[model samples]
Target: MRRHTLSTAVTLCFAASLAAAASAPSEARPASPPASQTARQQARVPVLVDCFFHPEVRPTDFVLACGDGNSRLTSLHWSRWGQASAKAVGVNIVNDCKPYCAAGRFHSYPVVVRLDRAQPWKKRPHLQHYSRMTLEYPAGRPDTFPPTVTYPLWN
Candidate 1:
């Protein structure tokens, strides 16, 4: 009879503790924004960025290598052409850096490119070429580069 009473008391205590725990509230935390909401806030066009001229390939041509293989300027349509200066609307292939940077898919964004005035090449004066290049981005550009980017001849 004593053992049965002791066991009943212990069981009652355990049940009370469980009830107390169940009634208690959990810790509160701030909820983060939804994926679509975040995407909407950052919804802007990508830019034509990281442009340079590899002299070995050709001085007249410029390469837009923006880390990801897809973010590049493949073609340029010149509106004005001159020995000293030139202007063109560049057709660039930009990529959303999703999944991973190296394997991202491509998107198109048109940008204006200008080679304003020729300067003598530091090593080769015979090649009187434009050393200063500017890129005009419409909607967005790299945080590191300005809208009007003046790129060097051999960057």
Candidate 2:
């Protein structure tokens, strides 16, 4: 009976320790940035750029969020990583285009993406400093568009 009690206690303690380790936060998690309005610096700012779609074949369309607002689109790029990492974000709106409409202007918009060399580079609300974005667009009307994209680092 004494042996049984000792084993049970040890088992309980081990389980508790494992649980604590599982929930602990690590260095990979950075702190959030402060709001500074003096400069055009973006608090939750993403590296953004507008690109034109040059189609070699006919034109195709994808979904997107766009307008005169922040989450809007005007022109599009394929994502520097191409169709494979498109989910990490390949295209975005180009406001430079006057009137904001033209052939191959894209319709299906994917969410924002972080184009980190690492797969699934999710954005953390607490991250400080700027993260780089890789912009890609439909070049040559090329016969491809990424089927998936990641979020936060859209260009």
Best by TM-score: 1
Q: Which residue pairs collide in model 1, if any?
A: none
Off by over 4 Å in 2: 1-91, 99-114, 117-130, 140-155
lDDT of 1 by residue, 97-131 (tens): 44443333446656787775565544444345566
Superposed Cα deviation of residue 115, candidate 2 (Å): 2.5
Candidate 2 lDDT at 10 equals 50
User: How large an RMSD does model 1 have?
Assistant: 26.7
State how far residue 69 of model 1 sits from its true place (Å): 5.0
